[model samples]
Target: MTNRLVTLFKFGIVGVANTTVDAVMFALLAVIGVPLLIAQVISYSCGVANSYWLNGRWTFRDAAREGNERAKLIRFLITNLVVLVLSAQILMSLHNMLGWSLVMSKTLTTLMGMVLNYMASRYWVFRLAIK
Candidate 1:
């Protein structure tokens, strides 16, 4: 339990850093006149790679899976895609049904997605090493 909590703490720290990276990239792309959707895709991809590196090195180091590096990266990307879908649903529910402000909805979405991301990273992307 304590270890899990510690992992969560590390994950949160990495998340904050990755979120900042995403926002900065998105803002830079937008300011340079990239279309909003294009900017979002580019920024989100940046965050995905950042998440994998930080989480692998710091957040779930003990759980890092033993496998081909390419396979691990592929799994990480797929997990993030699922996380994005779930977060989109949460955001719609919070913003549309619950009448939350856009910022509030997004904040909630990010928090919820973090849980999924951690679980997937631990059990799937970074599963305990084979003996």
Candidate 2:
């Protein structure tokens, strides 16, 4: 239980780092006149890349087996792609249909997407092989 908690804490810390990457990239793109959706997509892609590296190396270090890093990266990209699409849709709906601020909409969608991403990555993308 303690070990699981530690893992979760590490994951959260890594997530915070990823969030900063995403937010800063998004803001920078927006300031340079990028559309909200486009800026979000670019920023989210950067965050996904960051998350894949940090989470695989640090958060789930024990779960990373002696295998091809490329394969793991592909799996990570596939998983995050699904989350990204869903999150984008949610953010777009809130920002476009409901007139919510882009920042607030992205924040809400990101929180929801984070839960789904963690579950999918832990159980499906990076699960340890059982003997």
Summarize candidate 2's per-residue lDDT along 1-131 as a digit string, tens digits. Answer: 78667877887898999989999999999999999999988998898889988888887886676457777778788888888789889999999999999999988998888888888777766677411
Lowest summed lDDT window (length 10), candidate 1: 60-69
lDDT values for all models = 0.87, 0.84
Looking at model 2, which ten-residue stretch has the lowest summed lDDT?
122-131
Residue-wise C-alpha lDDT for candidate 1, range 26-121, written one tens digit per residue: 999999999999999999989888999998877876656456778778899999999999999999999999999999999889888998998888
TM-score of each: 0.89, 0.75
Model 1's TM-score against the true structure: 0.89
> Candidate 1 — what's its lDDT?
0.87
Error of 1 at 88 (Å): 1.0
